[model samples]
Target: MLQLAWGLCLTALLGWDSAVLAAKFRRPAAVFPLPLLCAAALLVYAGALPGFLRAGVWGGVGALGALAVWGALRLGRESVRQLTESSGLMLFLGGAALLWVVLFCLQPMFFQWDEFTAWGLAPKMVVQNGCLYPAQPGNLKASFTYPATSMVTVLFQPFARWSEWGCMAALDTLAMACLAAAAALPNKRRMAGIAVFAAGFVLPYFFADTPAGSYAAQYANAMADLPLFLLFGGSLCLYYALGGQGRAYWLTVLPLMLLTLTKDICFAYGLMAVFLIGLDLWWAGDAPARKRFLPAVAKALPLAVAVVAAFVSWGRYTAAVTPLQETAASVGSEGLSYGAVLLGGVRQLLGIGREEKFAVLMSLMFRAFFTRRVCLLGGGAAAVGCITLAAAAAGCGAETGAARRRVVTAYLGLAFCFAALYLFHLILYYYNFGESEALALKGYDRYLTPYYQAWMLVMLALLGQGAGSRRGAGALCAVSLAVLGIFAGRGVPAAGFWSDASSRYTLRQDVQTKAAALNPALQPDDRVLVISQGDDATRWYYYRYELTGTVADGFSGRYTEVGDTSQREKGDFMNLVSPDNEYLYAGDCTVCTPETLMAYMQETGCDYLLLDRSDGYLQQAFSPYFAGGLQDSMPATLYRFAGCDAAVPFTVAAQESGVAG
Candidate 1:
């Protein structure tokens, strides 16, 4: 926890000094987010370059820190002024939010599926090995192609030890930074900024079906969704507030770069941001229409180049380090690559021969627009449009017309981008997932909610701009607080929120404890097969990550379905054996028998078998093969295949022994 505090302070200093240097020591009106964006961008590069070079990531971090220190020294008193200029309300709210995050993150466990597989795994690999996932030994099942931007965010500890709480805290800090950026609009009405900030803070709860139980649950895990959307939306807010002035170009480009580095799909959001910047520029200035076109293009050119560069560079890097089989473009069983599948999906979208899957996708997407929780784009746009028009009708000012036009333009632009992104996902899923999973539109909200969240922030920023006077702004602030209070009270329970968050990962914690106890008996070089009956295949990943020594080679459950016994041949199940296999369902077949099980152990070079949960089949059919009659422990059992012959029977022991080994 002390490590987390030090890391947070170091990151804050680096971010602030870097932003100050970038701004040439001159304070901007919307000062809070520039540092946040700068820090995120700096961390992305600092974390990434080390992986590409196979060097210590902390060395790169140290270099960045030194540079920030130099910049701060040069700025002198200006740095102190920059800190003093930040909004007190924004700071207080952000601090309060960070405190809540720290408490929630103190659980020290990863609850989400993606956390163990990709998001959490990637970072753990980096911190443990001081390099990328490719450099890690054993069969690492994480998506190696996935960018490490989010991974670096949580690397606060100096030692190689991984901390789940630290990861959550670091990421939640980034999220809060984004909210602060969005709220720090360049408006004279301080109350208006407060209102916008307050709204943006509680916006996640507005969604009916959040992935987690409570609002705090959203930030308690180390997933890329929350940070990606917040950064995307915050970039737009900073651009609008700063007006894309002299040093503001760097601010704009840095956040977009961070956005691009966040996830593969987020590159589109960065591109959309670039286009919107150009559009805003085109709408600004009273120059002739013909002259405005080239100038707008010229101004947006740097952002476009930066985004493209980030995207292409990361793509090339991942391609170089990652195997062809591990990539998203890997060929499937149908003799078509994922790229080919995407092209086919595009053809279906263009009115070529369509399938039932395509129809299902279209129906879900169309229906998503009407769904209250999903259609944040439409809902936010409506609210912004209505507010702008109402202000204009009441004779607020001529500024309302420009604000209205900007709102409409942004709405149409984002709506189109959203549709394109949805289509891309629909097609991508069609190829990557099973028919049922694809048709169900799994992770629909998780994927699309980022865009809506970002859109809402932008709408709030625009709304803040159109707020006429201090009186009206004060009223808006009061109303926003009232709404926020009501929603927060209903959405997050005071008594249960912390306890529920802390207790959410009790099962995972139990797994870790058992793994720690069992790890001493296992050798680092040994290939171990784990059997956890009636559990999800994903549990194998949990064991694989938790075990300090030996590799968790494969997993099999007693209740797994084995289709068509007649068609299966002797030793046919051996074909499924691989280091990469997440779960190998060795059903109640020939493989479960003593002789066949011995053969499997011999063939796979596995000398040890761990029964995480023992069942009837193990005791009756396979017990004699155990070298010492089931080396039992609390809640788990181990079997040694070294001494026992397949045909020999050994003494059986009680399964309920309270032994450690």
Candidate 2:
């Protein structure tokens, strides 16, 4: 039912956008891009409008009415028979891809702390309470930095918690479905466009993964990352399809904004969109081009204003009310040998850095072409068979120069857009880190996961062309398939992502079990303070991050001096600095010894003290207010502090609250 409704709503939205672009720009006879891009959006809109109105979305209904006007206009003038027939193949391919993605790769488990902070926890918080909670029952309290993704998720969460995931999934699926339908059109430009989507974003199935194969598997929300990535791509496609201007501009803005709200990574796409539009405006010539460009400018205007305003407001709020701090050691590139960094860069270019990159690339190639994994021994072969249809492009194409240029222009423009986006991130990392391999997570490949597959697919498609005349598309696909199969069989051994889960979850268990064995050492409501050897020990403090008042970190707050402090003085602190009174310890204070923590805790009236590592807390190193003795640091034990000047102002909460949603 939701699927059917979404299809109509999508249709209405796309149809209206197409009519608006055509009416404003007055494209010659028919614009292929407009129809190709706008078709599915129209269907989804048509399907979704009535129910959305009935649900008391007066504003959404108003938007629906406006889109319907455009839908009616487009339908009145443009013939759907050819367009529907033309898009049929792509629609089918995209739907199949959608099914494969939803069933196979996507999962529901919230694996990312980043996602936990932004989406999973935020909506959970918002639905249960009106305003955001500063912190849960566990540790420190401060401002909320959760991004917009939670707000988007929260929209459906209010009705019913169960409906929340289902709503998001259904809408995201519709977006994917539209993307697939758009790709199935019957022209070289259309096919190339489809190829762009295939290569750039969605991963080809890794056999017997999620929905396609087994149910109990590796992921919890395999559905999320891909949907947002495709939204970014399809939004771009829609922009170009609607001629990138006029009322047709809304086609791009609506999706781009929605994508922006999906996650922090996606906000980068919104920035990218602004850049692309600005570039288009600068490059375009004459009235027709201007017509397409201007509406885009207008459409993007609202977002541009809103985004800037929001940033400014948030920036001001943070600066005046709450400050967000970051570490230069982690963020900056200072001490590494530049020469070695350059060598590391060369290693990556030479396929030498981590096996993971090679493994991912190898896995992608196998998945794109063929899967020989034991999990998908039979019918999955037929899915790869569709690659055979793509070969038809070899024989069927525009024979004329003018026709080829149009097709080439669109792709070249898109390629340039991607190149610019990649270089912008790539150079930033290189400029800072020189050539650090550990810098991969700093937005290199992860931010661009959806688009990576496109590059892989294009390689295959180009290869397919070479083999088209002699071996036939089937053989080309089959051979490609065979290559992927072999790679899939061996890729897992190379992907070692869990190298760090060791000590953390396990040591946390040891800590908990050992502490539990010491029965009545602390009551359920009693506060236990944690002092890591240093900030690095926090990695082994996973249970503490959950925000139960039972455990507290002496250093989610406080000053540090363990490592080099050439850049960060007291002036460098970006956040509030109240001593962590709940727990006081000196585990491994490279710069801050037990002496400093004990006195700080004593002055703050903290009740517990723990010590580790035979190092001085630098009582001589700090003022008495900031120092204490750590001469007895060898015995690592948690002890009670009997003498304190005054108690902390706040009492610990009895129960720990789950994330916002």
Candidate 3:
């Protein structure tokens, strides 16, 4: 409940200025609050930017809090009423969605590997040190050089408490804001828009079989993907409004800046949005091809510069601090030519239609737009709808030749922009993964969620302008609501209610609690090295990462689990830091001798060893070091290095004599 209150207060505080400014520029009322929220997040980021120090963040939040209170008190009766009505159902849906996030957060089930290690760890270190730093050896479970957005997670850390709830609230707020933006389509057929967006966005959580997979799986985890997608969707809407209504599209710089600050992949998305916005501005009118283009270019230059500057800033920081892989290393040794990769990518895109499994992907995307599955049997239906809608509008015989041409150009331009962005994304993916290997296309559909939403918005605008009658609008709205009701009736629960024991909720809160209780037994400086057999050490990482509250290290059966790309040097370094089961620490003996194991312990400076008793390989390899006793719920054994100094000198002397081999 406190989290909900804080979320509302923070939203109002941050949004008031941006909303009022957007209103002055005649931006849509629904989108007004969205920009304000982003503005608020950016403001908070600015505060954290002075070396990302904690004191700076407090000062910024304090000032923003006072401003928010002042704004609330000064809202005139008419202004208050207008704000209330403008928010309407979108606010309710957003609130409801947040409730689900809160429920998951309470369970605090952080199942995604990247979340606990990469996204969650970055902000945590910032909170602990009061500033951002490079990923150190002891804490290299995640990508060290990803980018700036992970630090934004720090905003959710309540009073710098390092609570999971705080991080959950921050991410949920972003996700909800995005949904609200999507729901804020033109108020004409507004109910239909709300129904469609609410159902499509919310239903995925309840139904496990969704084509993009379970929506609940995402919201329930700590990944930044959902928020990033939503932010990208909001940016697309802003660009759509810019092209269609000619509002000050330059305000899009806010979303672009936020996007650059969030995820590495989104840097590319930010660039794509800027390019499309520039294109829209350049061709916005009925004037001769080049007359008004210069003015548009002048308006777009600042936004482009902002994105470029952000990219450069992020690049410089990572280059200085993070040991990220170079492009050549990322490409691997398979040596598939760029031309071959490009050709393979083209074939894959073209093959989506003929493939039966892609039928699900097409169906899901179409439903995202039209809501009704009746018209979404395959991609062919979408192709037909675009063609039919175009032909019907062309035959309306209602406008001058220039006007008709303009309409065609606008519809074609929107489609082309979406296609270009998606194709470019595919090309990049192919470049990263190579020809045959890229065919798997893992997580590709989820990544394209924003593009799907953009396509829907464009279709709506096309139908709104060209269908030429309220009847056509009414029919689409009705069909959309019907589809939405069918899904929402089953998926969304009563307000503030959630199924805590669903299949999506896999982690045990009880187990986590028990593990964390053990932390008090160890000293702050005492290092506990953890090892698990057969490569699955995900739960162990979460246990240590959350409970320890310090930079910690571990060994796993696989290097890939510890953020190793296809690089030998990194793998060797990891082996040196924490030897895996594969390493020969024991000579002739199946299990490691006390002397050899003691030397490893001394090298790592780990005073205690945490081993998974369930893992046979770990038990067989390290039984000599076992000091005894298992912990419940965690099902792991604790082994202490008793008088570790005795074996260390023996092992060192043996190494000096070349007998360590």
> Highest TM-score: which candidate?
1
- Which structure is stronger by lDDT: 1 or 2? 1
**Residue 248, model 1, lDDT:** 50
lDDT of 2 by residue, 222-291 (tens): 2345545555555544444444455545545555555554443455666665555554543443336556
Best by lDDT: 1
The CA lDDT of each predicted structure is 0.59, 0.38, 0.50
Clashes of each: 0, 69, 2
Judged by lDDT relative to the true structure, which candidate is superior, 1 or 3?
1
Q: Which residue ranges in model 1 land beyond 4 Å of their true spot?
A: 11-74, 88-97, 139-145, 186-189, 208-216, 328-339, 371-404, 466-486, 493-500, 521-526, 549-591, 598-608, 631-661
After superposition, candidate 2 runs with Cα above 4 Å error: 1-108, 116-119, 132-146, 160-219, 222-228, 243-246, 261-268, 274-321, 324-407, 430-443, 451-553, 556-661
| Candidate rank order under lDDT | 1, 3, 2
Give one digit per residue, the lDDT tens place, for model 3 in 180-201: 5555545454554454355335
Alpha carbon deviation, residue 589, candidate 2 (Å):
7.3
TM-score of each: 0.81, 0.48, 0.71
lDDT of 1 by residue, 102-145 (tens): 55455557776777667887767666655556545543533443
